[model samples]
Target: MLARMLVLRFPKEVVDKPIVTNLVRNYNLSFNILKAHIFPRKEGLMVMELRGNRKDYERGLKYLKDIGVKVESIGQGIRRDDEKCYQCGACTAVCPTGALHIERPEMEVVFESERCSACELCVKTCPARAMIVMFDKAVELEEELA
Candidate 1:
């Protein structure tokens, strides 16, 4: 199955539509909703992981665009500043994706960009102001490790 993290913007006009349901029923795609804010008559945001056949995934994405949904990939938005972070583990507590975790032996906080959903929980909860959110996705985790 092809899996990807996506940020879907539901316009006010389509806020009440069954767009997600159609993705499952019509395109045979499976979705895991990571975070969502859906209010009636207002634009909504949804972060999710979608998995399915490559062909079906393409069709599903096309359908979303055709129906006026603004779709964007969840880029590498979660950033950590090593110089400022103190390994407090506060960010780990609120992270729903477990992208932030503590290493058992050394008691150090670790970040895995691949697992991040970019819900911005860590950014808000970090007391050290080390966890930041950015829009670039070009950087790889291995490069940071090096």
Candidate 2:
């Protein structure tokens, strides 16, 4: 099955609080939260993952909107770029999902696309700028490749 995911970027203050807990309790939804760091900036980004039907996803989005979380962007499925990767492992260190892993034996790194929530932390942490989170339209184009 295709796992559906969404990335919502909120102000640092909003995410640093108990809002996430409230979201879980109030919406009755399960989510994996990731802290992302986009380029040209030092602050982190917040990505939320939701599972289940389209209706459920939509409901969660409505809840987010009501609460005034400014969503930076949203996408479905995993996003990564192998060509841009330099295997530095900085992205792996900061990945909340453990989606990116570095194997010491070969000094090789792997990106588990299935586990990625498109938080863009990898994108930010990669000094080489290899990782990225493709937005809506881009998501469609990449689906076939994925």
Candidate 3:
């Protein structure tokens, strides 16, 4: 079996297609949609975890690309700007993956990038404009660096 986190960008033309259904029915794959922003007649975006047999995974990916769905790995993730942040813990409230949290004794905000889902909730909830997305790997910074 194979599993991967993929971001599928679909053009407006194929917005209404039963692409995901076809993957399950024809390719014998399972999906967990992590995030999506799709609307009819508009460019759509979907981030999901796909799991299936090795051969089926390969064939299904090829099919996705062949049908105008732009596929990319979810290597990029969330980051925090320590200089801009005040450790207000506002972002922690909106973080679904518990990537952002508050620490005791010092009232510090610690970011566990590994637990993040790249959902962008922290970005939207942050009033101080402290959190940002890193378009690479999501790794927690050392205390001295951050």
RMSD of each: 6.7, 8.1, 7.3
- Give the poorly placed runs of model 2, Cα more than 4 Å off: 1-4, 7-22, 33-47, 51-73, 76-80, 136-146
Instruction: Mark the 10 consecutive residues where model 2 has the least summed lDDT.
Output: 35-44
Residue 67 local lDDT, model 2: 62
Model 3: worst 10 consecutive residues (lDDT sum): 137-146
lDDT of 1 by residue, 23-141 (tens): 99999999988667778999887778899999999999999999999988855467899999999999999998899999999999999988887767798799999988786532332
lDDT (Cα atoms) of all candidates against the true structure: 0.84, 0.62, 0.82
Clashing pairs in 1: none
TM-score of each: 0.76, 0.54, 0.67
TM-score attained by model 3: 0.67
Q: Which candidate is the best by TM-score?
A: 1
Of candidate 1, the 10-residue stretch with the lowest lDDT total is 137-146
**Per-residue alpha-carbon lDDT of model 2 for 1-146, expressed as tens digits?**
12345555555445555656665676556767543433332323455566645565567668767766655445544566778777788888988888889877998888888777676666767887777665663454234223
The sequence of per-residue lDDT tens digits that candidate 3 reaches over residues 41-88 is 998878787889999999999999999999988665778888999888
| Top candidate when judged by lDDT against the true structure | 1
